[model samples]
Target: MDDYTWRIKMHQRRRRVRRERFAVLMLVVLSICGAIWYFGLYARTPEYAAKKLEQALEEKDIETFRKYAALELVLSDAYDDLTVDLFHNDTSLTPQAKSLFEKFYVLIKPQLVGATEDVICKRVSGGMWVMPEGGDMLKGRQLGIDYEEFLERSLLRSTRIKSLGEVTKENGSASIILEVLEENSHTPFTLELGMEKNDEGDWQVVSIKNYRTYLETVSPRIHQEVTEYVQATAGIVAKYNEILQSKQWDATYMSYSATGQLTKEQRTGLANYLENSVIPIVKKRQEELNQIPVPRGAMYLSNLRKESTDLSIRVWQHYVHGLRDDNIAEFNTAESLLKQMLATEQRIEDIIHRAAVSKAIPNMP
Candidate 1:
């Protein structure tokens, strides 16, 4: 072969190799670009956001949860829906009364919304509700509501997303329907979340589209649960009252206090009466009360009753020691404990009366 022909063939072979290398490089670049678009942009859709939100809630990933949820905006809209349902749809409320309530709600809406947001944030973060620094204690007392206790009873605290149903997107906005189950009631309900794409092209849940519907669906179950709780509590309270009334507890104590002083023989008799009679009865009642299962709604009352019973046991023990060892200070301590026990009893009665009169629970004694 001639030297010129060999050089021409070599040039053509090198040209072909260069072209193939360029094509392969371009293909690699396009593949990387496609992946960037899919994962970094297209993957951040409304449905993706909703799924992330569901996972965040399930895992209690507060930061990730907040990333997908516009908590303040969503809760604010939900509060409005709640008020509309409460005021507009109550058939028993006079139009004038409803107007008054609506006006009052508007005045307090900001504070209520802020408080609820705080509660939800704490709950999502797996933290207990603590009154914020510089909170208004006087106003809280006047409201006669325990926000923490209210949160404990609320459906929000127990809700779990069962499934993501459907997603509808329109003009940079979207709605996702979620099927949720509340652990407390074991009732499944649907929630529609309104979402919007921000300037960054990420979707965030901004509102609850059907909060009123959700409330209406859950309200009957809530009422039934409350009624059942009240009935069970009333039965327990009645049993406690019966135990207190069945014996002449006051008479037993009166015998010791009849005279300011007692002979040694009289003291011995009184000590025996307290130890063998009064103490056994009080201890038995306390044991029974301890064994009773307390419902969530009646926890405060149950605790108070338990405290009163404990004080009763202490009072009798002190009385017995005061008589046996002739210690006047023990007698004084018994008297103080008795006063505390009576005060606790009064508080329990006051709570029951308030609950009964408020029609919070019918047929409650």
Candidate 2:
């Protein structure tokens, strides 16, 4: 009986060992299959993906563009700097100030984003905006003879992919650098695409390198016009500074009689005189400087520069409004400072708007 029982126990241990070995073998096989799927069948070649994106853009296939295209949040100190004026530098904002800032951001953000995205699409599409024979580019509209072919004929083409390098892949991410030669140049620029695998393990485009490009397709005349507008704006700003520094507004506002003499009553409240009479002079100054035409669509850079100039002027307008509101609370403490600020403010206001002081410039139609 002891011998029989011992043989039974030995047989059970042998069966257990065989099961453990089988489990180990299954794990190894499964791991090899996983590696193959992650690398081969699921993941796409980076070069192929890059070429696909290029073709999608050139062909204006909105369907394909939407498939591979994704927006990436590339965080940087530069973005922080963009918001510095709103909060970082001025941490002492009152609730009202913060609310106004938020409202301003809400107002301007969509305009900035829409305009900038249009610019980006134009750039990525090789600056091919219009269709053949002055037709509107009806993207993905089954236009005859392809958008790519249309770009090949336009004078505004910005890129032709020379060659795509072998995709570099690691840790479930891939990237490729493509050499692009333009129609007018022998030298080439490299376009790098950052790609990552999605849940289904397909490689997708994450970004278009540094978004801004050096490849704008503008006419020489437009370039010259933009240059001239920038220079003229600088000159106008200089003249504004001169007028403010000369204290011409102060002199003109002090005591305007048939003659230039002031009695004791006339000199009593400088603030009162300014509050009453200085606005007309401001109006006249605004009229004189509002002669600048609306260079809205002249050139992209010029339009942006014009917008920037107006932005500075708007800040000054806000400052003056704040000062006036503060004087109501503080019993007019900074009255002299407010007066001088408004004086300087009006000059730039007149100059930048090229229109009117205290008027809103609609960023959109």
Which lDDT value does model 1 have at 228? 54
Tens digit per residue, CA lDDT, model 1, 80-133 = 776665543334567898888778767777776787777677767785554434
Best by lDDT: 1
lDDT of 2 by residue, 1-365 (tens): 69999999999999999999999999999999988865685445555556667688778665565456553222122122233322422335666886776565455444333433454466665644543233434222233222322222122244467777766777877777766764332335576666776565455777545322322212222223433454555656566556554554674555476665555455444444444444343444444445555342233333333443444344334433443443343334344445534444443233333222112322322
TM-score of 1: 0.61
- Most accurate candidate by TM-score: 1
For candidate 2, which ten residues in a row score worst on lDDT? 72-81
List runs of model 2 lying over 4 Å from the truth.
1-43, 72-166, 178-191, 208-365
Whole-model lDDT, candidate 2? 0.47
Runs off by more than 4 Å, candidate 1: 1-24, 58-61, 83-102, 127-144, 152-154, 242-365
